[model samples]
Target chain A: MSSVLRFRDLTLGYDRHPAVHHLAGEIERGALLAVCGPNGAGKSTLLKGIAGVLRPIGGRIERMGCEPRQIAYLPQAADIDRSFPISVFDMVAMGHWRSMGLFGGLGQARKLKVFDAIAAVGLTGFEDRSIGTLSGGQMQRMLFARLLLQDAPVILLDEPFTAIDARTMADLVDIVKRWHGENRTVIAVLHDFEMVREHFPQTLLLAREKVAWGDTRETLSAENLLRARRIVEAFDREALECTRAA
Target chain B: MYDYLIAPFSEFEFMRRALVGSIALSLAGAPVGVFLMLRRMSLTGDAMAHAILPGAAIGYLLAGLSLGAMTAGGLIAGVLVALAAGAVARFTALREDASLAAFYLISLALGVTIVSLRGSNVDLLHLLFGSVLALDEATLLLLAVISTATLVIFAALYRPLVLETLDPGYLASVSGAGAPTQLVFLCLVVLNLVGGFHALGTLMAVGLMMLPAASARLWAEDVTAAIAIAMGMGVVASYAGLVLSYHAGVPSGPVIILVCGAFYILSLFFGRASGLIRLFSGRQHLEA
Candidate 1:
């Protein structure tokens, strides 16, 4: 497979304090990669850098052929406000934003696609329901429906299964697998090691720095996991900026 | 009853002017207020209302009750505070609410000091409590024009504004419209506030905007419905308040706000969205 994304000694963080440091790797096109690490391991931050939401503090992330809009980023559930006054259909329809744009009309074809996405996610009868009225599982389902509409080449999911019910999680996992089947590059930050192992073929383990990056079986061994835990725990809170050349 | 209600508006041109100006303000300000409440920036809206004061006060000092000067001044001050508060929240560790509160307090103090410096008590009352019943032709035209412009701008901005308010991070990822959308939305708020200040004084202008929007929120499930209901409620409150003020020999601005407050109270008890009645009945239904 061709390389879709190349991370060349990437360091990403807020206020010059690197959360993700000296990460160098290539994510192949259509790769199903799970980014698994303990808390504060900068999994989400790495996704942000790839999504082009945050500028890297050092090094660079090069998208081989994908345009900026070809990447769909799903932030953590906490980043979304469920109280806003919008219907489920309208929220899900936002996935078509890449094509519809700010002023583009949602023609009959696109509308049909939106309906299909909603129905696929088992939310057919909920098109008119206000988003605020949805349960947590239903909301996740609706967001996944939106992601379906996005249909981007590169998909970044940050803690997608957190706080969701098993049924919803199972449904969303299937969608991710389907994306992999469709030859889409998928990178997900996951806390559930079992889910990662079961679904993802490749893994990147990080602990404020890279621990391992390879096949899931080799990368997630007990020794590597323990080392990741130790490296994260022993990381200096007051470490000075790195002066090394990239 | 006709003589008391209908004749006052028919016989008095000032009453007619006041009614028209207020309805226009409601049409524009109510929708803007709905957005403010939806974004959970109702308090920021209030602060922005007060923040406009120093500029209007400066205008009042320079031009002596000129509508053109005061409107310009208020718009400039309101936008400045909005920008400054946004910057502080972005750059510093301080939260938006705290930064907004700090800026508005300073704005309010500065405004009161400016107003008190040269203007007479009567002039101060006029600035604090607007002279809605005495709106001249120019002020009436200004209100109508602003209302038209606001509605047109809102139509163009509707979809992007909704996305921006609902999921800013998602909007940022998809398109570059997020920051510009926020900037335009803030400009609309400032525009509506300036229009409202002319019809309902700085102190009570936010009431016509916020109270109706708050009441509408209890009644409507979606943003479009909330905005429509708020506008309708605002118009009703404006009409009722003006009639009552004419008959009762009371001030118009506070009367209009009081009428809006009555609607809010009614909605709090009886509205279907999240009213006390619905809450109680839902609980009872669960128990049953």
Candidate 2:
């Protein structure tokens, strides 16, 4: 299969301190890949780098055959503002932003699509409810509905299943599988190894850098997981900037 | 009741002028205030109100209290201060609120100093507290034009503005509209403040913007409804405050703000959404 995303010695960080450092790999089109790592191992940072929300401190990420907007990104739930007064239907309608654009109206067809997506996520009765009143699982389902409307060639989900119930997680995993079946590239940052091993075909294990990559089972081996934990524990708090050249 | 409530506006030209001017300010400023509160920038909006004073004061200094000059000066000053504060927050260790607070405090002091240099305490008080009853035809037209422009721009920018407020990071990842939407929103805030200061003064202009918005937030569940409620509250408060002030022989600006304050207090206690009464009512939970 052709490569969709290539990380060429990419480094992502805040305040010149690299959170994700010196790793190189390619994500093939239609690949279901999980980025697994310990806390502070920069899974979210890497996802942010790919989403173009955060700039790389070193090297670059190359996207092939798609514009930036053609990639759908769902950040961690904590990044969302639950208190903002927006209804579920309107929030879900934002997925059509790619097609309808800034000034375009939500016509009959688009409204139907929004409703269909909401129904797909099993949020039919909750359409008019304010997003602030939604439980955690319902919020995730709503976000997934928006992702359905996005209909992008590539999708990046950051910690999508955290704080979610089992039923909701299963439903969302099915949606991710559905995207993969449709030949869309899906990259997710996940902590649950059991889910990753069972569902994901490929995995990139990181501990501020790559530990292992390729087949999910092999990448998430006990030795590699232990090594990742050690590497994170050994990370220097006051280390100077990396002298290594990309 | 007619004589006490309606006669002052119907019989006196100045009272009518004050009512009309405040209504325009309410219509424009309330929606902007709703967005500001949503973005949690109510304090920033208040700071921006004060930031306009130095500009208006300089205009008064140069042109001797010309409406056009003061309005233009306030707009420029407010925009500059906003840009400077934003830049400082982005580039330096200082936060946006701290930077904004610093800029506004300096602006307020400079404005008072500038006004006092040429004009007496009476002129300073007029600029600070506003003289709504004395609005000229030009000022009234300015308020009308501002209200019209604000409504049109709001209608056009509504979608992106809501997305930007609700999910800025998501909006950034999806489109390039985030920066421009934020910039336009800031300009709207400054524009409304400039328009408001013409009648409500710099000190009290933010009252017309924020109090009604806060009161509406307690009552409305959705943003559009909140904005509509806030706008209605502002207009009502303006009309009521004008008549009350006329009868009480008091200043119109402070009375208008006081009326808005009263609405906020009443909403705090009795509004349907998230009010004290609802919390204390102790209704049992519905079955799932």
Candidate 3:
């Protein structure tokens, strides 16, 4: 079957260096594709390119049978602070940005969907609380609330489980599994091998270049992993330490 | 007690205008100021505050103290400078703060030079010190108009502005988000700076924006609540500043800034978020 998202010889980068080059991959419908590599392997950049936050420099990125607005993207929550002055309701309500029309206000039905999404993430009674007051896990749950509202068939996440609670991580994986069961394509940029082994069967191995793409066990070989580790652009001792501890 | 309450209300028109004008600006500036603090754009506010000096000089040259001419001239110059800064940031290698500081500082230096060359006998105190007792009807009306328009627009565009401020990639439109929208917004920043330059003057006009908002942040967990608290602090301080200036016979501008300073200082000790009071109180109180 034709995949949901197809990247054909995709080349992308900042001005000087090549971050992701000569990447060719297809994400099958209902498959959980975990992109694994070391730090600075351009996993985040690739997700950003696919999410429309960044544009590709070469080749093709096709969203077949999909519109740009329908593709749900969970960007790295780097700029967002836990101390920001916002409510969980306001945060999840952002998912309805497109449906709100030009004025950016949600309809009554969409509003209900927001509540449903929050409940799905098991964060009931959190709608009115300040986002700043939440733990990292709760914050991730709130983001999932927004994601549920999008209800897109294709979901792209850039390191969603970083610095969050174990329970939230399990919930997130289960939610991803649920999405796959529903025939939705899920592409996630992940650093943790254990997470991929337990949750995702399909894997896409990348390190600024496409190393390998196949079944999780096949692509996550020691040799391929060593190559990915060697080629990864940044030295994330912190992430490695966390992985070891986990 | 009677004097404290009734004197301000029954005072001279300039006092009434000063009281009203400062309150309007404090309310308008407080909300925007809170966002600026969140985005770390308070430095931009400082830069822009100083940057408007040349525009004020230009205004002085054209109107010789005509509020309309001065406001128009100052706003025109402010918009142009902000537009230039925006364009430079988009097109050049220079970062936002570096470019803004350079442009604003250079303009301020140019202002001093021009004022020295063209102005009569060059009394810098009027520009720096401020005289709230000199506000006329026209200036008061202008303050009212700016206040109303600003508050209304802020209410309408609050969410998008917050989102855009937090993350540019996710939601920002590619089409520059238009000049008029930006022009009006930046002009508000500029108008508050330039308009208050006479009554409260340049430095404090900028300083008070950050101080009250920053203090309010310590007390509030939500943007709306923070904004409300900030406005309350700003208004009360504005009145206190004017009264203090009246009693002490010191300059109004610095006194007003000093009042905001009080709030920030007090906030450091008593604020809900990072307060010394909370730190001590929590330790003393038993917990599970």
Candidate 4:
């Protein structure tokens, strides 16, 4: 399969301290990859690097055939302020930002698409409800509705299922499967192993460094999981610089 | 009854000017205030208001209370402080709020010192409290022009501003609209504060912006609705305050702000959006 994303010795961090250090990998076109890691394992940072929010400090992130706007990034729920005065329809409609540009109107066809996405998420009656009024699970579902409207070739999700209920998870997992069926590249930063095993065919286990990659079953083996945990635990917080060879 | 309400504005030219000035301020300042409150930057707005003082004071020293000089000074000062605070937050470990507070506190001290150098206590009071009832044609024109510019700029920037405030990360991911949107929004804030200073003075200018916005947030579910409600509340407050000041023989700026305060208190209980009354009733319903 052709690669959609290529990370060549990529290092992402804050204040020169690399959270994701010397990471090297490729996410293939039409692949569903789950990035699993412990706390501070740079899963989200890696996603941010691919999403073009965090620039790499050491190496390059090459998007093989996709433009930057063709990537959809769903940041963690905590990064969003739900109390802002925005309705569900408006938030979902933001997915059309790329096509609409800055000042494009929501014509009839686009409005229908928004309503359809909302209904698909089982939030059909919540078109007018403010985002703050929704429950955590409902909010996640609404975010998935937004992702649906994005219809991007590359989808990046950071802890998308955290704090959501099981039913919402199932519904969203179905949406992820649908995206895969539609030949989109999906990379998700996830902590739940069972969900990853069941849903994602590809897995990249990281502990500030690559521990394992490829098939989900082999990559998520007990040994690889143990090694990842140990490497993350023994990591020196005060390390002056990364000494690994490029 | 009509005479009591109408005479203050109709009979006297100053009252009429005050009415026009405050209404202009409400139309522009209230919408900016809505964004400030939405961004949770109400205190930052307050800080920026104070930050403009030194520049206005310097203007006062240079041109002896000339409206153009002071307005220009206040705009420059407010924008500089905002940019400096933003830079400090961006480059340093200190957060934006801390940096803003630091800048504004220093600005307030400098302003007080500058005003004290040659001006009398009465001059200082006028500078701080403003002469809303005594606005000349030039100041009225400035307010009107500013209000028109604010509305036009807001129309052009409406979508990007909304997206930037709601989900900056998402907006940044899609396009490079975040920084420009923020810069324009801050400029809007500074402009409105400058306009507010002409009528309400530096100390109370943010009150005109923040209070009505806060009250409107409790009542409206959408941004446009909230901004509209905020502007409406501001105009009503200005009119009521003007009438009250004319009869009760009190300062107009403080009276307008107090009227805004009353609206805030009323909304706290009665507003449909997360007001205390609604919260309590919703909890009761859930329990039942």
Candidate 5:
């Protein structure tokens, strides 16, 4: 089979101005790609472009041979407004909305899908829990549950583990490995170098441009490493190193 | 007191008109009120309600035709102001509440000017204050038609509306569900204002529409349950308002508003979310 996603000379932005420029790449079917960059280096922009949220300004995005409903997204947990009074079940069930009629008259079949998704995310007893009651890790898992119900072969995740604790990161890595085992295509934006080295086989290092991209071993060059840490050099490193050691 | 309560519905057709029309308006106002709370567009309801004054006067100028004509004119005008306010809020740096307030003030002034231009000083007072007891058969029919149509449309567009109201940004970008949500919601608000104009008057229409639904939120944990309870409370307020107005011979609109206000007070004391009961109970747990 051909690559599941193709980005050729791609440019994307909101409001007719390009946020990301001239990105050319392709993802083999079932590839696990990690996109790493400093904040506002257009990492989210690239994700949005691929997901069809922001229109690509310059080039074509050929997402070959996948139905619209066959794409799932796990956005940052903070992105969801918690003040809304929807329960965990309510949020998970929404992934089936495209199949549900416009009015969402729920049926036995769709409900089974939602239950299966919740089980897959390991939130077996949280079906009736309010979103406000969830801890950060639980919220992340709930988002995965929603995406699981989508039953898509491709998943785009934006900062799926940031701000959450280390346990959350481990839980998320476990989920990613599960997806990898299933041979599903996974694209995630991250900031951790350790996890990229440990789990993901491919990495895309970015700095408002594609600095380097290849297998993890190829991308760990001293030049790429220096470029990734360049933004942190302006700060005092003495106390920072001490703090890191502690 | 007994005679006043029993005799109105017992004998007078005008009294029956007022009571029947009030029931329809309150029932219809519930769903629109629930959405306004969720969307944080409560102030838009306020702006549209008052903005119809000049249109009501223009409606009065064309008033010789029928109640239907007058109401249609007012609905078109209310929707125009709501759209203008909505567009400016979305497209500019101005806060939506401030934009709504500006529209409301300007529309209120213009409505007064139109009434002066029509130059019927006494009739203008009746429009502002309302005379529910003076309603006729035709006005009641218009209320019925508007209320029924508004409720039906709300039931049809329920989920997308709730989804967009809770999270417009994601719905707009990733999902593109915001467009349909905005259209259905504002349209329903205008429909309620049109029906409400007959009984509560423009000055008080939104107060009746909002106060009960707002209070209902403190007690509800989900959208579906909130709507059901709000509709029931709204119908109860309608019945109670008419009964009190008959026995007390007071203004029907204000009586209904006062009853709804009382419900708000009760909710603040006993409702679940932020009620005083929750506060004291929480304090007890902390101390323990």
Candidate 6:
């Protein structure tokens, strides 16, 4: 399969303290990749780097055809303000922003697409409800609906299922599988290894840097998992930078 | 009842001018205020109001209270302070509110010094508290124009503005609308405060903007309804305050703000959305 995203010695961090350091890989097109790591292993940071929200401290990220903005991204639910007085329909309709520009109205065709997306997420009757009133599962469903409307070639989800109920998780996983089936490259930062092993075919295990990258089964082997855990647990705040260069 | 409520506006031209100026302020300021409150920038709005004082004072000093000079001066000063504070917050360790507080404090001192240098206490009072009852034709015209411009811009940028307010990070990730939208919204805030300063003065201008907005939050469930309710509250406060001030010999600006405060207090207790009473009374449990 052809690669859609290439990360060449990418080092991403905040305040010059590298959280994701000297990573290198290519994400193949139509790959369902699950990025698994312990807490603070730069999993979310890596996704942010790929999504173009965080600038790399070193090296480069190369996308095949589309611009970084064209990639559909769903940040953590905590990043969104749930108390804003917006309805589900209006919130979901914002997914049409790429085609609509700033001032375009949701005409008949786009409106129908929005309705279809909402219904696909099983939130058909909750269109008029305020987002602030939505439970955690319902809110996640709404976000998935918006993601459906985004319809990008590459999608990045940063901990999309955190705090979501099991039913909602199952439904959202189906949508993710549907995207993979449509030949869209999807990279997700996930914690649930059981779900990852069951669904994702490709795996990238990271602990601040690449521990292993390959097929899900071998990459998630007991040895690799133990190595990743040791690398994270033994991380030193005052350690010198690695002299190894890619 | 007619003589008490409606006679003063019909009988006196100053009352009429104050009423018109205030209504224009309500029309624009309310929606802006609602957005501000939603963004949790009500304090920033207050700071920007104070930040305009030095500019208006400088204008007063330069041209001796000409409406055009003061308005221009206030706009330039307010925008400068806002940009300065914003830049400081973005590129430095200081938070936005901290930088804003520092800038507005210095600005207030500079404004008070400038005004006190060339004018009497009455002039100072007029600048600080405004002379809404004495609005001239030019000032009234300026208020109308500002209100009209504010409404048009708000409508045009409504979608992006809502998205920006709701999920700024998402908006940033999706499109290039975040920074420009934020900048334009700040400019609108400064503009409304500058316009409001003509009738409500520097200190009380933000009251006209934020109080009605805070009250509206309790009563409305969505942005559109919140903005409408905020505007309605502001207009009512303006009219009632003017009538009360005319009869009670009180200042109209503070009275107008007090009326807004009254609405806020009432809404806190009895509003339908999430009022104190509603929280206490509770609704029936919904079936799964």
Best candidate, DockQ-wise? 1
Q: What is the C-alpha RMSD of each candidate to the true structure, in Å?
A: 1.9, 1.9, 6.1, 2.2, 6.2, 2.0
Using lDDT, rank the candidates from best to worst.
Answer: 2, 6, 4, 1, 5, 3
Q: What TM-score would each prediction reach against the true structure?
A: 0.96, 0.95, 0.84, 0.94, 0.91, 0.95
Task: Give candidate 3 regions above 4 Å deviation.
Answer: A38-40, A101-112, A125-129, A163-165, A221-246, B1-4, B80-104, B121-123, B167-187, B247-250, B282-288
| Model 2 spans > 4 angstroms off | A237-246
Per-residue alpha-carbon lDDT of candidate 6 for residues B138-185, written as tens digits (9 for 90 to 100):
999999999999999999878888888898878987888888888899
Docking class of 2: medium
Give one digit per residue, the lDDT tens place, for model 1 in B108-226.
Answer: 78987898898888877877777898899999999999899999999889888888888888888888988888899999998888888887878777898899999999999888899
* Model 2 DockQ vs. reference: 0.68
| CAPRI level of candidate 4 | medium
Better of 3 and 5 by TM-score: 5
Q: Which digits, one per residue and each the tens of the lDDT, describe model 5 over residues B57-143?
A: 787766632576668778888888888988899999998788889998998898778777765766776667676777787888888
Each prediction's DockQ against the real complex: 0.71, 0.68, 0.25, 0.66, 0.34, 0.69
- What is the lDDT, from 0 to 100, of the residue A106 in candidate 6? 90
Candidate 3 lDDT over B35-75, as tens digits, reads 77886788888787767777777777766766766677667
Q: Which stretches of candidate 1 lie over 4 Å from their true place?
A: B282-288
Off by over 4 Å in 6: A239-246, B91-93, B282-288
The number of residue pairs in model 3 that clash at the backbone is 0
Return the top candidate by lDDT: 2
lDDT of 3 by residue, A1-246 (tens): 877888887877786355887788778777789998877788888887777667787777898898665778878774665567788998888777656633755768888888888888999998999887888788888887877777788888889999987888999888888888888889998888988988889888988888889999999999999988787745443432112110
lDDT of 4 by residue, A1-246 (tens): 899899899999898888888888788899999999899889999988888888899998999888776899998754677888789999999999889986789999999999999999999999999898898899889989999999899999999999888889999999999999999999999999999999999999999899999999999999999999998888776887668788
Q: How does residue A16 of candidate 4 score in lDDT? A: 88
Off by over 4 Å in 5: A14-17, A67-69, A77-79, A228-246, B1-7, B64-66, B169-175, B282-288
Residue B177 lDDT in candidate 5: 62
Between which residue pairs do clashes occur in model 1?
none
